[model samples]
Target chain A: MTISSRSGSPGPDAAEETTVIPVVPAQDGADETTTLPPIDVPVLEDEEFEPQADRDATFRPSRAGWAARSAVWLVLAWFVLAFPVNFLSPFTLGVSDVSAASEAAIFAIVGLSLNVLLGYAGQISLGHQAFVGIGAFTSAYVVVDLEMGFWFAVAVASGLGLVQAAILGAVSLRLTGLYFALVTLAFGNFAQQTVFAIPELTGGEGGKEAPRPAMFDSDYSYYFLCLGFLAVVLFLDWRLTRSKAGRALQALRENPRVASSYGINVKAYTLLAFAVSGLFAGLAGALMAHHDEVIVNQKFGFQLALLFVLMTVVGGLRSRSGVVIGSAFFALLHSGHLLSLLEPVTQTIFRFSLVDFITGTIGLPIEFVALVIGPILLLLTITMYPGGIGQQIAPIREWMLGRRFDRHAGKVTEVEVNDVRA
Target chain B: MNLPLYEQLALALTAGVLRGAVYALVALGIVLVFRGSGIFNFAQAEFGTTGLFAAYWALEIKGWGYPTSFLFGMGVAIALGLLTERLVIHPLRDSSRVTLLVGTAGVALAAIGFQFWWFNETLVMSMPKINEAFFMTPWGAVVTVQELITLGVLAVVAVGLALFFRSPSGLAIQAAQQEPVASELVGISVRRVSMLTWGIAAALGGLAGILAGPYLTFSAGFLSFGAVGALLPGFMAAVLAGMRSMPGAVAGGLLVGCIEQLSSLSILDGAVPGAGALVLFVFLLGVLLVRPQGIFVGKVATA
Candidate 1:
């Protein structure tokens, strides 16, 4: 019910700053802004008082508090980096788990790529598997046949991804809403059936090898390399979303007509979003090709497209941390490590192996766990927890940032993926 | 022996029409749901697949009579439609159309996953045709009695729907769809009408799956991505109908089918890989660009 004003970092557009949070409750209908304005003027004009008295009351952590927070932050960082390699850890993890961690990072990249389209631009692509698959095949062909290095293959793949997305962006201009989604779905099928079936490019059904980059051949080292790439992508995403282009995309997504009227080039920003999404997808695909050492056409099916959407939405659209965690969680589920990780907890609760219960009593295979449970989770997320894991963890993130842990700090009013009729 | 060009065209036309029958059925279902609830109903094709699996289980696994199994499949599909309307669609009715679309897609994925889980042991499965007899057309393309039955069913259903619209309950459905608030004031239960429309659409989809399943071996998402892949074509057909007109849907389905068959011509055989899918894609884009209002749908006056 409270409307919080933003502090620091004044944006170029003052109007945008005022309307950014449009968080006033719609049901109330009574405008509360006029009733209780925060008068910044001094209250006690007759009494002598220190000028900085109000500012001194603001919560700034003491030196010891800062040290404790830093220690906790370092532990969290170590858990992410060191846990995969079993360095100073209690649990035993084989190389396969480490490799799976690499896949998780790659999945996070794909999820972020989707967030650009679905979250930022409000464009849903049902054929993202095609986008990623083309990248995978392009990378593999460049590396294996042309004898190009990994970095060059990656560049080519990302470039090709941009080209393909531009082509689709043209179609998207003609079709919006469900019609555009249908086109993407058809494109995905076409890619799976025709493009990937080419014996020359994809090596037919057998697939083609994509060698790991030189000096990072070991699994542990490769894991670090994936993490480094993930960090770069994260940084790029952060910078992009904070730029004017990001603001333009948000404007277009809300109302293209109004945005265009305000001198924003809706078409250009939309294409930019598509280009960025495709680039990230391509980068992930190239990484995936080398991670598996071989890329096959079958891996980029419609199911994978659904999986990508699932991760992005369930991760909570537009929430970077949520998308990363959701994608990694699903990746772990796909790799069958999630069940094993939960085995001890389930055993303590249910007095039996939960993994065994799922595979034995339920007759669901480990690999199929994500497919079966993911949709259920997606349905629940959309219907009940619209903000998803990101919204749920907002308070903690605020607390970590040395702010008050207000439970409603990052609440999303409503997911605005509707009425995209053009 | 290579066929003459005329003969090849004849084969393509005949095959296209036969295949178009199934597309028409699927399109009818899509149009119905779109008209009734304004949902794209991504689960429309999955309903058929789920029904086909149910029928397969009853006939193959449970050793039920064919007629009984077919009815059971339709029953299961209708049940699923009602369940979907109650659980996912109704709750999301006030949400955005895209959210409803995503919800239906989620329903579809769940159904596909359940199919995979239930029928995992049987790696490949096929339903028996109603009649095993086949006759060769003048173009040398063989036609099965099963296909003839499919065509016959499409005709009957189309005519039946036309006549049903003249009936009282059908009028209620039409009224509710056009003006739900006014219809409610007039004592028509809008909720029941929605359930009825979804049930009928699901039945139509189930019919398509049961008929099309015999054309090839079936698996999870058969009508979606298998040899009989009808989801995209069905959507194309619905689009060609402007997602509203039933008769237009039938015509659109036939037109889309024939257009897709153009890829199978002898001249274009090896030149284009996945020619059928590619042809369909291009045809869809062209239709959307040139006549997005639909080739078959007549313009209606808006107030």
Candidate 2:
């Protein structure tokens, strides 16, 4: 210490000056004596703090994109296959029976419309069949009474349906799930009463027959026509799921609060979703009216509404394929074949009509299979596979690629399942 | 089209109030179930129908009943209610509100189907005419003993339920609704409480149905009709009450009944022929606009 250092050692100049400590710690806990000059650290300006070049990379779809594309392709292929099958098959699948296929297609349309609202939007509508009825009634009136061309009738019917939906949407826009459901129920009943009351417009209890379009002279042609409509509806559905509006609707379904926070006009979107859904429903009704060559008030009663809800729920509300599958299954069952098949068994067991046997045994109608089964399936899906059948299949496809399905690996939590439930 | 003012007004009010009381009773039954549990009890009318049919069987068909067919019908209704609660509602205690509501609807449909299968005929039952002695000419309007009984029963039940909720067991029941998990954790047995609620609600519905049966003849489709009547008023009441407060439910019911009666006397009688339905919609819309939470209760926090 007494020895003179390079700069100073207990010198008067060093003692008079202030010694500044370094803000940063030394790498090692070693002490060394050295003379050092003052250093100036350069401060980077705001312009120097730029994001990485990778941040400007071109947009890329997530893994969900490929899965969605495959789904779309699969749907298109199914439609292509169904088109010929609908034309060739007769009422029964037994011998040239296209009736069953055509009926399935018609129901498929109804189910799809319901899927748009109940499935994608997560709104429960008990009055969907009312729209169907309105479409049928309007189209029937136009085609049969107004003597409008079939396509013209369809156009007019769809327009009327839009108006009906708008009015209903306006009235029920403020209502939440259950109250919304009740209002729709009341409207359905009111429609029925009005139909019955206005015998001049509707044939009332006697019912009225609708004329088939000239284009579809034969059953095969009618089947093809229905298939065409179904195809268009299916395409529209595909487009909807892919479109921005569809995503917005889906966002609302997932979490309206979150969606609204992102500046989505919740009411406008809800109304739009409802209107689009009604448009499809109306189209289905118009097709049905022309297909059956009859439109009855009874066709759109509360029971039909219940059946429609059941169909959508059973088909797996989140998937278009599920809706179609559910609809087809229900239509086939409704064709009375299932009941006929069970006739012998029913006779032996209860000695009653098939309706009685089915309804009495389970204390629920066959139409209510969805009601009885849907919740269980939904619960199971919620617990085990929260994403429904569509999302569940992705992992299998990924596994086939010799890769572990790790997209949702750690992100899939119990809370996510509860959130989906909500 | 041009009836005397006094006559038209009196008749309209009379019909409205009388029908309104029936609506109130039916609605009260629905409100009970809704308040106890979140379910709308779509089968409330069917419960009434079951009672009516049971009364018919006991009084007219079997002819082995010491009591009047009316009393017998009430008994059968109580039994059916208990059975339904135990068999159906009890098992579905943990179901979501929508599921439960749909379940009730299913019950309704099954009940209707059963009635058709069993009865085979839709013939209406003819009960003994209610005596007119109890009726008095108030403002030249005739009010029947049946209507009085309906109003009285509604009052007693409403008051009784209010008192019941204040008791220790009622507090447990309320606790079950407020915090079902916590109540369960505390060994309160949520399922048992729900079953009890179902039983009580069903019995109230059955009683209402039996009382209303004599006025509107019993038939297979009677319950279906009754369900509509019950649904409108009950739904209105529940919505008005914010689906929580019992007092709110009662007040909502009375208000609906009165409004319906008053609307019948108004100019709207011609425009919207469904006066009762119109009144319900208007009131529901009004309440939802002004106070969606309901009169006495606050906003419906759960559903």
Candidate 3:
């Protein structure tokens, strides 16, 4: 018996999908017939062979599920927009708390800026504070000395950031891995000690004043401005990760030599990333300057750079929502607002205020709490949960997007970021 | 005490040499770890700080003898090295080098935090030098006995390392580092080699700390970011060594020290604030661009 290849789907007889018919050739010198299983050909119809992805794509959430997701979305939106403004929420945020919220938004922008370099380009900057500091100082200089408006100052700062970062990127492009990191560290030190030390520029020890925009003078309005900037940054970041340049960056990050072999201009694309990162950082720095109403050189220290790296890494690289959340969390913690927010809960649960426990019992100042606890969290994130908070909240994010809840949906089997080539 | 320009230059050179010895010690530890494992250990300087803090605790807090405290500090540094290797490094051995760098940095931060917490009462502390006397150089530079001791120890360490590499265990470490699979086939315990290298490197870092601790009043991150900052210089030296040659590291350390001191020349005094850092930054960029394999190093290192 011979098996024939069929062009169409098998009929009712296709129940036995795999029919192993053994045949013995008549020319065999064996007394017994040796069974040889023939290859079973799959008779699949062209129109019927749909992939699992297509099935998932065809899925539609029930009306009730859609209603639930929309409600949750509304709550989240209200929490972000109206809670602080005391519009629809019962709990009211104080003036200081609103200011802290603005800081959080700025931090989120900074985190995304770092994410572009570390997560996408696979370059680490230990002196990121330098970039941010330059931005702040630029904005302050423009506003104070040049008598520029808030918007013009921010624009100048961001442009300077792009120019400076591109220059630094060009210089360090020849180096990679730890060597590049060392250069950034040195540059940071240089900027801190030499550049920031100029009395005329940084306004000496007293620092420079950066007034808020006229319309956004109040803390509440300023917070909305920050949130609006954050939204713009988030949009830009989302666009970046989906573009051709972003693909090139991801390629080079995984393996620069391989990417170069494929005709990708590693240096050009890396410089683009640096410019973009710098632009965002400068914007953040300008916002930060107005937020504090007074920007000082002392604010941009080595510790702050490390904190930026920590929040970005802990927030999970390459995850937009996660970075925003992580940056906000750290900002709130740094402002001491997070502890106050959880004061009542800690009072009930642990029988003591958490801030008092950290300050009095643990003998650590409130200001240093993030520095101390952040590193431990960083270590845990890198070792055990490489995906970080983003991975943790992935299932819920997917569920809200009208997909079936998958516990392991966004689980990163291995860290997407790779080592810089020597 | 204002000397002529040439005399001042000579004095600066003399002082730089004395400071370079400590840098040499730190560079040695950095080079050792890099050669052992393909990692840029950010905690190398922090290891020194930890050791210094431990010695400080032993001496001032516990009222122990100087020699005993020094040894105890070395022990603690070695223990921290082993702990870091076992806890953070070993588990992520197969991960990318950047991850390992981050891990080491985390370890350093944690240690710094612990120091800040434990030694919060004393913001600054000083240790007595081995000898209290100072000797004036021909050019009028006053050299302390402690500086001479540091230089002497660095010479001994350099010679000792040269000899150690020819020994069986040292050779085993070299073999394991070069080719782990081949070394394993030859019945070498790669794990043990890694542990020994880390332990020795930590000890070297500890020695640098103990010797330099007396040079200035120390704070939490004494050798890292404090008054007697040596981490950047050490890293510069290691890069100058191409991250592989031990002898090159020693030579590189001295050269870096001299170059850094050149910023103190009269011409650069008011031209730039923090001119030393500017010089170092420029020098680093030049070296990286011109001879990335390092000035002292001849051959390319196997990555």
Candidate 4:
């Protein structure tokens, strides 16, 4: 049928019609005498083949559903804001705890940055620690040595991230898959051993003292600033995924050859994604440096990069909420304060601190909890649940978003463990 | 030209060769696993570190004889390799190569954690050198006995691999690597070959760690990112072989080593901190950008 024959909706009459797919009998069609009648196969109705836009009609919740969604959103806002500020909450948060919360928010931003490349672009970056590290050092140097304000420092850091990432993206034009991974790995080592070692830039062993911005000096205010940045990042990420370039990334990632055939500039779009990812990472890094007040090179090591990857993977590749949660979980875990908070739960569960329990039962020291837990979660995430935490929480998320809480809501439409290796 | 400058160049060259030997040893394992499984195993370095740690415990803590400790270390390495193949690789065999790479990385992380747990109390663990003597060159470059022995070991391993590839079982491994389904159809158990390949690779990694550990003050993840960050260099060496050729991997390792040693030159070191890593990073980028197929490998259009 021609395009003109298709309608917005199909009538019942179309259901009666059928098409047949040829059924070849006998091995290699050797037994021609045993030919059988053609079998009927289902054919797509004109309405079924309508434009993709018409098919994905948005779900409109009822009045009560809308109210519930509003309530849920309000709770989410309050939880994120008041919990960190220790205002209008059951318990007050200390300054360091508030700082940890800020770090968590920054980590969520960094995780989102990785999701753009690994999730949407189907590209891998093993040297992401370097990306974040460069941003951290850049911002620190700008703020401390150059004596610039926080806003200018963040801008310069993000620009550097964009430029460096674009250069790396250019490399991806020639090399991909494992080769690209190797290059990133090399770059990470370079950043760690060489770039971070520059005495002037990193400010030697004590590191550069990246004091908080004048206005947002208190932990409470800085937390809000980070939250604001995270909100901006989240908004940008949402817009990118819905934008033309984002769809192009998804298509090219599925099959570059076909995408190129369809007139997509594979190199240009991939570079755009790299720039976007790098921008967010740089912004997050700058935020993190200021969060600590004293930035050091040791924080962003190879293991940190590895943790970032597995955390994102474990969070679920393309799921925004999942990645953010996973990133926050790791950031909290890394800071050690999260474990202390969990001590009460562990005491009730195992009569000792979680670290002691792990050492006594699992034979692992407390210092390496994430080192062990992260991997187990990663393996489980990839093998059994490719959707990660996002997939697991999808049904609840759908319900909260004014949709029916269907049991199979989070069914993995696509199972990709970092693409199909080209 | 000044004689001192000539001596410095000679020393750098000598150091590069010795360093490259260790990289080549690690590269062999990388190439083996990549060929047999078509997955880039990031845990290769951990296998080395694990073996080194196991040996350290035996020789130092338990006071086992050197020969027995060496055997124990190799045994541990083989066991760990087999376990990895069974636990992580087997479960994710049908997954994407990237997923497999992630799985191997998980294995590496677990090993690193275990090492830290066991050796957290110990600081700056050092492996005893096999021999104390050193051979001095005319240019004043000192070559330790351990370095000479490592070079000799590499030669023997290369020759052994050359010979193995010619044997029946070796041919089976080759067949399995090149065409797993076809080899299976012809009665070759691809599973056994896979296990064998990983085992061999792990042993090689272990040997590299045991030999190289003496050259530096070692710790957990030593081969991966410690004082001797051999993993990336080893990978570059494998990339130089186009991630395929066995003999080419060793040669690539030596080349990478020599190039890396260039950063130790006083001129570069004085000019910048971490000059060696900068040189390595530039070299890796140059290699992939310039000749991704490697100098020795034939070029073919690929996805």
Sliding window of 10 residues with minimal summed lDDT for model 4 chain B: B294-303
- State the DockQ, from 0 to 1, for candidate 2: 0.17
lDDT string for model 3 (B19-120, tens) is 888888999999998888877887888888889889989998899998999899889899988888888888778777777877888887877877787777
Assess candidate 1 and give its TM-score to the true structure: 0.91
Those runs of model 1 whose alpha carbons end farther than 4 Å from true positions after fitting are A1-57, A62-68, A344-351, B166-178, B301-303
The local lDDT score (0 to 100) that residue A352 gets in candidate 3 is 80
Alpha carbon lDDT at B200, candidate 4: 95
- Per-residue alpha-carbon lDDT of model 4 for A224-294, expressed as tens digits? 99989999998999899878787788778777787789888999999999999999988988888888888
In model 4, which runs have C-alpha deviations exceeding 4 angstroms?
A: A1-72, A348-352, A359-363, A413-422, B1-3, B297-303
Clashing pairs in 1: none
The lDDT of each candidate is 0.85, 0.64, 0.83, 0.82
Q: Give the Å shift of residue B161 in candidate 4.
A: 0.9
lDDT of 1 by residue, A254-310 (tens): 778888898998888888999999999998888899999988889998889988988
Q: Write the per-residue lDDT of candidate 2 for residues B121-207, one digit (tens) a residue.
A: 445565443443455575667777877777787789878987887887777777887788898998898777877777777677776
Which should have the higher lDDT, number 1 or number 3? 1
lDDT by residue for model 3 (A1-422), tens: 11221112232333233232222232342445456433323323322433443445556789998999999999999988998788887776788988988899999999999999888888888888989899999898899889989999999988988898899899778888778888888888788888888878888799988888889999999999999999999999888877888788888888888888989999999999999999999999899998899888888877788789889888988888888999999898877888887887789888988878888988987766776888889888888988778888888887898887668766774454454756
Listed per prediction, chain B TM-scores read 0.96, 0.85, 0.96, 0.95
The Cα error of candidate 2 at residue A372, in Å, is 11
> Which residue pairs clash within candidate 4?
none
Query: Docking quality tier of candidate 4?
Result: medium
Q: Which stretches of candidate 2 lie over 4 Å from their true place?
A: A1-104, A332-337, A341-422, B66-96, B121-144, B184-187, B217-221, B224-228, B258-279, B295-303
Chain B TM-score, candidate 3? Answer: 0.96
